[model samples]
Each structure stands twice: as structure tokens, then as C-alpha cells.
Target chain A: MKYCFGVDIGGTTVKMGLFQIDGVLLEKWEIPSHTENEGAAILPDVAASIEELCEKKKIAKDQIEGVGIGVPAPVTEVGIVQNTANLGWGYKEVKKEMEELTGLKVRLGNDANVAALGEMWLGAGKGEKNIVMVTLGTGVGGGVILEGHPLVGTNGAGGEIGHICVNETETETCGCGKKGCLEQYASATGIARLAALRLEKDAKSSLLRSQEHVDAKAVFDALKAQDEIAEEIVEEFGKYLGHALANIAVVVDPAVIVIGGGVSKAGEILLDYIVKNYRANAFFANQDVQFKLAELGNDAGICGAAKLILD
Target chain B: MKYCFGVDIGGTTVKMGLFQIDGVLLEKWEIPSHTENEGAAILPDVAASIEELCEKKKIAKDQIEGVGIGVPAPVTEVGIVQNTANLGWGYKEVKKEMEELTGLKVRLGNDANVAALGEMWLGAGKGEKNIVMVTLGTGVGGGVILEGHPLVGTNGAGGEIGHICVNETETETCGCGKKGCLEQYASATGIARLAALRLEKDAKSSLLRSQEHVDAKAVFDALKAQDEIAEEIVEEFGKYLGHALANIAVVVDPAVIVIGGGVSKAGEILLDYIVKNYRANAFFANQDVQFKLAELGNDAGICGAAKLILD
Candidate 1:
């Protein structure tokens, strides 16, 4: 049986998985990311880890297909990364270096994009080729898959859904230095910001006012108890997210929208509000788009990274 | 030299073209569309014309590549058109029928999409493979081409840019049974509607008030003459179109946006207002997207239809 390695490189950890050609995971492990010295050791470390794993498993080099990597930065189709601030790398030739170090073919994709591919392959979007996956983490991330391939545009900027301007009139700036980005209203932090804004707007209180640190988890927990203020905050968050997805549907018309990330831990309850707003704003022809929760969670990165080589 | 046939079936006429495999238009002509009898005669007519041309030119079947068709309706990847209200067709197997009739390989695409492809091949987006083309005619129609292929969605609803909800708070309903659609403000008729609304909001002394019919042309002509009310209407139009495009860019990250259709007759002046608002609301990474006017006018359909076969 042929084998392949999937690697997800984040700021702190390098997650790796060995999988059968047909997608069955044989083993998975991690290594701490050595990002000092411009992340010069990161590729070397990854290559050494793969070599060590192969030696321990007694797998021949010819048995392995290649290595697929998902990086925490925008990656060009050719495997060049312009800026990986999180990984302490600047304009690195990731694919070339990795291939040279391990003498294995390498494929690279953006983390969020590969995660979406994972979902499409074996997670919530399984069996569906066209899907839009939104990750509502500390910051919102998006990955668009069309016909089983990620929609990686000319400059690797496709599926930058978090930066979509949902509210054009807002004065507040987003982390991208843009005003009224979807990330400013629909991310995990954005949800807490909504709760904060709601609390600041009115004295109506019950659960949130009692919390010292209000976050997306707290907001959902409070709403589960039928908190009126939490309800409003969720509604506003749903409007921004759902409306943005509706707009996205107009462009790509994905069969399903998979919601993941930290905020999605709120469970299926989150989809209720989001689906309601999505239907209310979606184009007539696209009103029936299915909404599903991402199932792979953290493992999505590795699985999706593996998919990169298979594709 | 191998030859191909490009047929663009419109509501009133069917424009047919004979092209060399290299994309040179050898000959072109038109035939009246018989939309009566549920448009049953349309495909048969298209086939007969192509067969007659081959016979007249003494071209054998071996010398022909295939035929590409552009229909005025949503088309699935397999070339099934769910509804063609203008052509009086419903639930038609366009590709199968055409292939049977002509005994040649057949390819079908949406008219707007093929027009965008035509522009990409030889018009404004000549060298670009990723492009979003918006046709601002009686209505706003869009075609998104990625890596030189039209993005045909699950149910053929992809690239329906006109129906995106740009203004969620709008009370007036759009033609698509939605409220606040971009088409309500960005189409040619939408521009006239904006002019009407602007004139009605205040008794502003403007050149539009004197016109019997204040259409998009009147608004642009008045703006050129430095009419204040006309400028306001154009600004509103530009805001809707430009902002909607910015949202689209975040989803697909196209290299260029090609503007076409009837309203583009206003020339470079139209690009000014649109570019201004687009820069104001676009994501930081996508602020440099190029905007160009479509170079192929009515012939875009035929050229793009021809390209469908080539692809």
C-alpha cells in the first residue's frame, strides 16, 4: 500500500500524519515549531521528523507518494509564501526547501483552504465537491472549494471571506486595516465585541453582566438559558455571517456552507440563527443552500493537508 | 485548418459564426429565433444553419472541431437549462439535443458567462485567467471566470451577481422576489430608477427633470454636462456596483473586473465613480484589482461561444 505524510504547520506546533493512499490515517504526531532565526530551522525540522518517522516505521522511500503541507499563511499555487508572520518566515520557498531536504515531492496550501478541502473530502462536506467553509475562530477564516479543488486564485488570495465588507459605513477599523470587514462582526472576538456593544448600548442584563470575561462561549451559554440580550447579539452575529455567505453564494454557488472554528463549538444552535438570516438574504435561486457543521475539528488541518497530495 | 461553429441564441435572433480552430472568425450571420411553440424550432434551426454552411463551404466533418452554444439562461455543467423564460424553454437538455442534431461534440454555457470568456480571450481581460465580468444592461448579469473556465455552480446559479443583497434594509422588492438586490440599483434600469428616486426625493433643478424619459443614458449625459442631480444618481449607482464587486473580490479574488453591457457606452467616465467607491470598500489585499471596459461588444457572445468548444 502507498503512503503519504500530511503536515500542518502552525505558529507553535507542527502536526504530522501518516496516511494510506486511500485516506486511512495510520499514525499522527506533533513537534514544537522552532520559529527563531527567521524560521530557518522549521523546514529542516519537518524534513527530519518525516525521515525519523519513516525509519521507525521501516517504510521504504518508494512506498511514500509525497508530503502535503498546510501552512498558516497565504501560499501561492507554486508553493511560495510571501509573508508568514505567524511562522516567523518572510518570503520563503517552502516547497523547494522541503523537497530538497526530504527528497520527496511536496505540495503546499493555505491552512484554512486545506481545512476546507479536508471537510469536503471526509468531514461535514463529505461527498460534496463544491463547498464554502467558514472558520469562526479568534479571527474569521474562509476556504472555498469548487469541484473538489480549492479556489486558489492568481495571488493565492481567493476565499478571503473574512475581509468581505459587510457594513460599508462603519468607522471602526479591522485588523486588515480595513473598515467594516466581516471579521470585525462575525469572528469569535467579533461575537464578544457584539456582546460588549449590546451591553454598552443598553442596561438590560442578566447573564452577561455577571460574567467578568464575556466571550463567544459565554454568549452561547447565556443564550441557551434564553437570555434576551444574548439572543440579540446572536441575531446580529447571524445577520453579518449569513448575509456574507449569501453574497458568497452569489459568486460561487456552493452546495453547502460548513461552519467550524472555536465559535462553532456553540453546536447546532449556531446554525439556526445563521440559516435563518442566510435564507432571508440569499438570492432566490440559491435559497436552498445546505448548512452543515464541520466535523473534523483540529484534525481537519492534517486530513486536508493529506488531500493536497492526492489531488 | 480545423473549423468550429459558435451559436448565440438570443430572444429574437440566433447569431452564428464560423471560426478557425485558432479563434479567427471566418464568417458570421444571423437567423430569426422562432420562440413560438416552446422554442422547439431553435435548436433545429441552429443545426440546419451549421450543416448548410459546411455544405456550402465544401468542408467535411473531419475538418470541423465542434460547435459551442450560448443560451440566455442558467446552464448546468452538463448543459441542462432549467428555465429559459425569454426563449420559451423549460427543463431542456441543451447539450444532448444539440449533439444529437449535429452529430458533433457540443458545449453549452450561459450567455453572460460566455461573453465574459469572450472578453477574457480577446477583449479587456485578454491576458488574465481570473476575471469577474459584470454586464449592466436592462439588468445586471455577471460571469466569473477562474483559471480560464466559467464557474458553473451546482445548479447553474453561479455568477448571479445581480441578485446579491447589497442593501439589507431596503423595503422595496426586487424582480428576483428579494429586497435590496444589487440589480435594484446597479443595472441600466436600476440607474434610471435611482435617477427617478433622486428627482422625487427633492425638487432639485436638474437636466433630468426636463427629459420625457430619464434613463441611464440621460443620467450619464447629464453628469457629463455637470448636472448635480445626475452626479448624485451616478454616485449611488457606483456605490452599489463597486461595493458589490468588492464583496465578490473577497470571495474569488479575481485579477480584473470587466464592465460591459449597454451602460458601458458612457465610456471611461463610468469607471471613475466605480473605481472611487471600489477602492474605498475593497479588502486591503484586493485594492489593486484592475478594471477594464469590455472590448468585444455584441460579438462577445459568438467569440465566447467559440471558445467554449476550444476549452
Candidate 2:
């Protein structure tokens, strides 16, 4: 009945959880990250909070095997956060510093990779050996797990699927400064942008007049209402998503691709479109691959981080 | 002193090679494949040739450890050439048939994957654990090796880089029945098409007058002569190549990418352009990943097939 701690560090909040070796989450909680000033200077507060939590639960330090932390940036081979664009943290030895304060071995990985690990180990992809998880939020992010191990690549920056080009025409720019990246047209922002562009074209749509501000959710709502422009946007977005996934399938060829994050809440509307287009775009032989929505959702990060320590 | 045999089965030729355990090529030869008529009937000929080659070389049957074959198409999990576009073969159990006839163990893989294995083990990608090999020929084919092993997906159809979509605008139709695939614009034929399209708009080029028939090489020659149209066409072609490579880098993050085949003969003119644009298009952290021409050239298939058995 050995246990471990998993911590998911985010820009606005930090999620933490306790898990047994068998992967059952015993407890979990969230706290403000307060990353405004210099970022990561709040380590002492995090350590103290964890210590207090353990004390209150009557858990001994010896009972916990290790700690795993998922950060929102690339990690060095030795567990240093190279740079977190969202958190505004730069090149810090997170594992060493945290381990010294908490008196436990620490493992660190990219937050997206960790979340994929969680899904691979215990969620939708539990029985699957090969998986590629794409998180479709404000921006798209991805992590690939091949044969049950995360592909960290040479520089530990592997699995940046959002930046992969889906459109070669250079019609849109991505946050990474590249044009025609998949993230520019398939992410939540991408959906919003497409919807806005349709509105600008003076396309007739009842949904456009019903919403004060158009976002990805509004696009999904319009799709629910069967709006032509919304249907076209979703279909086109799904085509790009499918094309990108098909390309990834040709490279990694995972048994299942788990779609996660805020935009994924659109559920079958998005997935149905993606699957149709994915089948049409994928290599003739890879048509049988499955697409599943991530089951763990927000808790996947903590669970995956915890699994890292358990593994 | 253990040795193995490797065979590369192409549309027109069958390349066979012998190699030692330490990645050294001992002997090699090529034979007409004659795959146009009922391809499975050619297996006996391949087996007889192997026996004759061994006998002529005074190599004992017992000294040969195994045989590996690289086929130019999708293979089943058990080493069957399911279907080959170039060879016109369908559902042939090559490995089992070859092993039964030759009295040696046999392994089969896709030709592109085998070439990547060859580069990873004995050529430009030597000593690297992760590599992606792209062959720019009539079409742009690719293979990805992650963590030192070839990526053979569920359907043995992984590494189909040629089918990846580079354009979402649906400007060009690919041979694979898809629109805007990377190969439609990056391969030798793709380059020739671009050259022809440019010639139609800018007919003042010396390239059009210098050659009776315009092709990829003619375009390269014109670029060397500082023809504006040729340079523009080359630059555009290079941009697409770089963009595709950058997209691949983001997903796989291989330590080095090896480019091979006839179009690669453009050498520095192509390499320099691809490198410059790849850096500009790639994510910041991936800018340092190496891109080089494959070292083995035509022998890659034979050597890689042999190395597959050794590995």
C-alpha cells in the first residue's frame, strides 16, 4: 500500500494529489500558484502546504515513496524547467530544489506529457500500449506515448504537435511564430478565429446574432443548432485536425488518440467530425485506429504525475 | 564472426547483401526482380539466387545467421508483403517463404523503414537513437526511428511521410488520391511541376530554352545559372521541404534527419535552403536539431535490410 504525491503546476493554480501504487487517487486539492512576481519563488509555500497536508492526514513521510511534478514547459533531462511561457519561469532546477525541501525523490516532465501518461496508465488509454494525446485548449498541445513510454526526444521538447504544420499555405500564424501550424486552425482559438472570419464574410447565421461574443463554445453551440457556417467551420477544423492526426498516425501509429482539454467538451459534435475526416485522410491501412475522449480530464495531470513517481 | 543476409526488393531489381555482426557489408549484388507478372512466382528465383551466391562465395550455409528483406510496400506483422504499389504484389508471405526455402530465419520491413534502419545503424544517423529519414525521389517517402527502433505502427503502415498533408487549401492532388499532400510539392515530380508552372508565367528564363524537356535537374541547373524563375521555384520548393521537415521535427524531435534519394543530389543548393527555412519555421528549442544527407545512397536499402537482421 505504498503511496506517492503528484503535483501539477499551472499558471494560475497548482493541483496536487495522493495516489497508491495501483493508481487509485486517494485525495486531491488545488491552490493558487501566484506566479506573477519572478514566478517559482513560491516553492517554500508549496512545500509547507504539502507538509501540513501530510501531517493532518496522519501520513508519515516514510509512507510516501516519491514526488512527481508536471510543469507547463520543457524540462531538461535532469529535471530543470527550461522556460515556461505561460508561467513566466526560466531555467530552474525544480526537481533538485523541491526534493531538498520535501526530502523525497522528485521526477519532472512536461505537463502535457504527464497528462498523456495519466491517460495511458489509468484512463481511456489504460489498456493501450501506444497512444498520442492531444489537448485542445486555447492552444493545441500533444504528448506521444510509444509502447508505454513517453517520447521525451533528444532535447526533451518532443511532442509539440500543435506546432506541426497542417496547412502549408501559410494562411494563419501560430504563437510559436510559425505560419499554418495545426494549432492556428484546430485549437479553441482556431475555432473562434474561424467563426469570426465567417461572421466577417456576412454569412447568414441565427447563432451569430444570438451571441454577444463568439468563442469556441459559441461555435459548438451554433453547430448544435445546425448553423451552416458553424457546420462548415467545424467540418473544416475537423479536417485539419484529422489531417494532423493522420500525419501523426503515419509517424507513431498509436492504437488510440485521446483528445482532451476545454474544447474537447464539445464532445461527439467535434469527435464525429474528426473521425469522419480522420478516416478519409489517414493512410489506407491505418483506417481502423480509434479516437477516444480523455476520461481523467483535469485530474489527468495530477494522476499522471503521480504515476511517474510510482513507475 | 556471425553473418547475415539482407535483400531489398524493388520494382525492377532485387538487391542482396551479406553483412557481419558489427555492421560491415561483406558482399552485395543485384538481380532483376521482374515483379510485373504474378509477383509471388518470383520468390523461388530469389531463393535460388541466394543459394547460388552463398555457394559461389564459399560461404557455409550454417555460417549465415538470418535473412532480412525490405519490400517497397506495407508488410504484415509476420513479414508478408501485403501490397506494393511499385512492385504490384499482393498478400505474399515473403519472410516465411524465403526462410523455408533458404533454411535461414527471415525478417521483413518496409523499404523506407529499412533504409532508416540502415542510416541509423551504419550511415549518417550512426550512433543516434532517434532519427527520421526522408527520401526525395519520384515521391517524398519517409521513415522514423525512435529510441533506436523502427516505428512500425499497428498496420505496419507507419512512416508514410509522403502522405502527410502540407496544404489545406486543396491546391494540388497527390498520387495517393488525397489533395495537397507534401509529396505533391516536394518530390522530384513536384519540383518539375513547379518549374513548368513558373515557366508558363515567366517564359523569359534561359532554363526553358536550354532543355528540350524540363525536369527537376533542369530546374536545378537553371538555378545554378542564376535564372530568376528557377531560383524562385527552387526557393519555393525548399520552403515546402523545410516546412514539412519542421513539422516532422516538432512531432518526433529526432536527433538528426537524414535526406536521401535523387533529389538530394542537388546537394548544398537544397541543403542550405532547407536548413535556413527549417530553422525559421521550427520551434525555438528544435532549431538545433541536425539535418544531413544520407550517407549510404543507393546501398541504403541493402545495408539497412541486412542491419535489420543483425539488430
Candidate 3:
């Protein structure tokens, strides 16, 4: 019957959720992220909302297990956030300060790691202890949950799968200033960029040729309508995505791989393409990796953040 | 004050070591592996060795910790060897059989994983909890030690790092029946193969043209002599190796990468090439990975097998 809070801190908003120790999320909400003054009010504001909830519900503080927060920055095992660039944060003792403010134990994890944990707990990768969840949002982000624990690395940067080089001979740089990264070909932006490149190269008699704005969605939509150009674009994207997953399989050998994000809304087709390509490139022993669509979507961050403490 | 035996089961010979609980090796030896009759004599042979050791040393049965064996096969968490193709084993209850035979506790691990653990315990990667050990022997092989423990996956095939696909366009198949695996580019055989390819393409005045057999050693010796074609061959090998390490870095984010196996005899030059390429392609945050040569050499297997019991 104990309760706990899972907080997902972002650049613009902080996603929060209340959950039972048994894995049921009872409530959820969001608070505007105050990055002003170097995010000075962010922690205090979160503490205040939690304190108010405690007072209004007449719930004893001890009845709650504590809080688990997922940060956008690299967080150490002791809960020190190195720096959340978007939050203007530069090394905060998150666990210590949060515990002092709320008078409860606090746990911390990276946002992607927490999300992968959340999925392993209640979303697409349920019942699987070894899982890898790839989020194809604006950029590629992922979490590695091995034997049910997020591999928060020596420097807390273990699951940065997006930066893995997929194309070694690239001219352009990635957002991280790397060239030929997986995020360049597998992210939403990457897919859109590929579509744009295709259209620019040779869009002969293609439906995408007429669209004013060509994007990842346009490419998938074209595929649904059986457009040849779209099929080619999707196939290339699949090649990178599939190859990336295959590489990860050798290192982690996860039981399941959950695909999520804005690009994943393309649904089964995306899942099938990635899986097919992954099988072709994966190590023989890891060829049968289970592929699943992320079910929690936006709530994954909150749910996974909470799972930090649950674990 | 307690003693234990570490056994490494190989295709042709079994390496055994005697150790103290405090990580001191007192003695070591080897025995011929009998693959006849479905390898039925393997366990009995191992047990006889341990039993004889105990009696000769006059060590009390209760004073000994147990035996830990590293098998050349996938070993489940519960110590079951699914099969050792070379050993003619098919799903042997390794732990139970060993325990019953020696009248002591027993544990099991994959040979590569055990070697990695051994290296972490007392070799090149000492004091580092997160480590990835790459073995470039006849074929590429490896073991991942995360958070100071072997990551024995659900199917005990977790550390199959060699078979990870590095070249998606590879038309030739690897020994594992896969195409363009890291093993095909980084192993001793792979390096020799690359040298042959380079020699065939253009070896106008190369020193390798003098040697009747251009092996991995010949290539490295040529590199030391500053041969042009050899340098090109090494560069291509470095490119694939560097890319593979960069890819593995994001997954494990280990503090150190230890290079071992027959090909590693090239020493600093080999380490330098892999590290140079690794840094170029690594994720920005994980660019400071420490690269070291495994110090244990041929003894890694026996030491690692013994270390498994310590864990």
C-alpha cells in the first residue's frame, strides 16, 4: 500500500507521477520547467507540489517509499547530476537536496534509462529483465536494462546508443558533433533528412515530389500508399536501424527490443522493417530477438523515473 | 585460509589452477581432454584431479571453498552447459555433476566470460568494475564484465562480441555463418585474410611479397618495418576494429578495454591502432576509454576459471 513519486525532468516541463510500490500509477501531471536562474526553483518547486499533496491527502510521510527522478544529464550512482545543458544545471547533489527538502529517500537515473526500466516494468517489454528500448524521437535515444537494472555506466553514460556509428564514412556531423552516428539515420530528424535527400536526388513520378513539406511521416504515409520512392527511403532507414539493433544484440543480447517515439507511430510496418533488418545483421544466437511497440509513450519517462526507486 | 580449484575445459586440454580465497595462485597444471564417448570422462577426470590435490595437500574437505569451471560453451546462470560442440557435451548439468564428483560446491561460466573476470580480478583491468575484454585469437571472442560481474545473459550467450556485424555489405560468410562480423575483420585469421586481399590487389615492392606465408605476424612485422602495403592493410583492420570498439563503448561504457589473444602479440602497435581509431569514432562522452594489453596471456583461462568461484 506504500506510495512513491516518479519525476521526469526535461528542458521545458517536468513530468511527475504517483505510483504504488506494486507498480500501479495512481496519478500523473506536469509542471513548467523553470530554467531561469540556472534552474534554481526546479527542485524546490517539485518539493512543494509533493509536500502539498502529502498534506492534502493526510498521508503519513513514511507511507511513501520516496521519490525517483530521471534527469536529462549524466547522473552518478550517488545521484549527482553532472550537468543538464538544457536546464543550465552544472553538477547538483540531487539525491541529497531532494531528500532534505522532502524528508524522504531519493533515487536518480538518466531519463532514457528510467524510460527503458518503465517499459520493462509495465509497457511493451514487461516480464523481460534484459531489454533495450530505442526511442526514435527528434533524435535517437535509448535505454539499456540488463538483468532488470539500468546500466548506469562508470560516468553514467552507458546507454547512449544513438551516438553509435552506423555509417563510418560520412561527411556531415551529428548533433553530438560525431559523423555517421545512428541518430543521423534512425532518428525522426534523420529519417526526414533521408527523405529530403531522396527527394532532392531523384523524385521521379513520386507522390513525395509534390509535397511542400517532406518528412518522416510523409515517407511512411507514402509507403502505406505503396509509393516507390517512399519504399526506397524506408528501406535505407531500415538498413541503418536494423544494423544498429543487430550490433547492440551482440553486446547486450536483450530478450526484447521496444521501439518508440514520434517516428514509431508508423506502427507495425516500422517494427517489422527494423526486426527483419535486425535479424539479417544480428549475431546468429541473437537472431530471435522479440520486437515490440512501446505502449506507454509519453508516460514512459514518468513511469520509468518512478521505477528507479522501485528497483 | 580456504582453498579452491579453478578448472578451464577446452577442446584439447583442460587447464586447472589451485588458489586461495584471497586470490593467490599456489599451483597450476593441465590434463588431456577426452572427447571420446560424448566426453563422458571429462567431469570424472576433473574431479579426480581435485580429489588427488586435496589428499596430497592434506587439506580438510570443509576447509576448501569449491571448484569453478570455465567451459567452452554457453553456461546458464544455474551452471548448465547447453552444449560444448568440441567437448561432445549436450546440456550437461556441469555444476551438479562436478559437485557430486568432487564432493564440493561447484560453479560454471563461459570460458571467455571467466577470462574477462580473471583479468578484472588480477590482471590488466584490475580495480575497474566495468570492463570489456576482446580476444583476437584464431577467431574473435570476448566477455563483458559489467559492474564487476559477468553479464551471463538469459541464454548465457551475452558476451558474444565477436559476431557483431561491422560490415553490412559483406558477401563472404564468417565461421559463425554470419557476414561481415567483427571476428572476420579483427581476429588473427581475419587479419591474415585482409593481408592476403591487400597483397593480391597490389604488392609491387612490399616485404610481404618476400615471405611465402603472409600470416598475422608477417603483417605486424611488416608494419614495424614501415612497409606501405602492410600499413594500408593495418589501416583497414584498424578502421573496422576502431568502429567495433566505438559501438561497444556506448553499450557498456567501460572504463577500460583489454586486448588479448594471439593477434595481440603485436603489442603496443596493435593497441595504438585500435585506440586511435576508437577515439576517432567513439561517442563524445566516452572518448577517454583506457586501452591496455591483457597481462595474463595464456594463463588468463585458468586464472579466470578459478576467479569464477571467488565471485
Top DockQ model: 1
Per-residue lDDT of A164-184 in model 2, one digit per residue for the tens?
A: 877656665678877888888
Checking candidate 3 for backbone clashes, the offending pairs are none
lDDT of 2 by residue, B149-231 (tens): 78877678778888876666766667788787778778999998888787777557475566788888888887888888888
Q: Give the residue spans of candidate 3 off by over 4 A.
A: none
**lDDT, candidate 1, B129-234, per-residue tens:** 9999999999999999999999988878789999998997888899989999999999999998888888999887999999999999999999999999999999
- Writing each residue's lDDT as its tens digit, candidate 3 over B1-311 gives 99888888999999999999888989999999999999999999989888888889889899888898889898888889877779999979989888888888898999999999889988999999999999999988899999888888867888798998888788889998889998888998999999888888854789999999999999999999999888988988998998899899888899999999999999899987898899889898789889999999878887778777777
Candidate 1 chain A minimal-lDDT segment of 10 residues: A197-206
TM-scores for every candidate against the unseen true structure? 0.99, 0.86, 0.98
Which candidate number has the best lDDT?
1
Each model's Cα RMSD: 1.1, 3.7, 1.4
In candidate 1, stretches whose alpha carbon ends up further than 4 angstroms from where it belongs are none
Q: Please give the clash total of every predicted structure, in order.
A: 0, 0, 0
Better of 1 and 2 by lDDT: 1
- Candidate 3 docking classification: medium
* Candidate 1 lDDT for residue B122: 77
For model 3 the local lDDT of residue A174 reads: 96
Better of 1 and 3 by TM-score: 1
**Which candidate do you rate higher for TM-score, 1 or 2?**
1
How many clashes (backbone atoms < 3 Å, residues ≥3 apart in a chain or on different chains) does model 3 have? Answer: 0
Quote model 2's TM-score for chain B.
Answer: 0.95
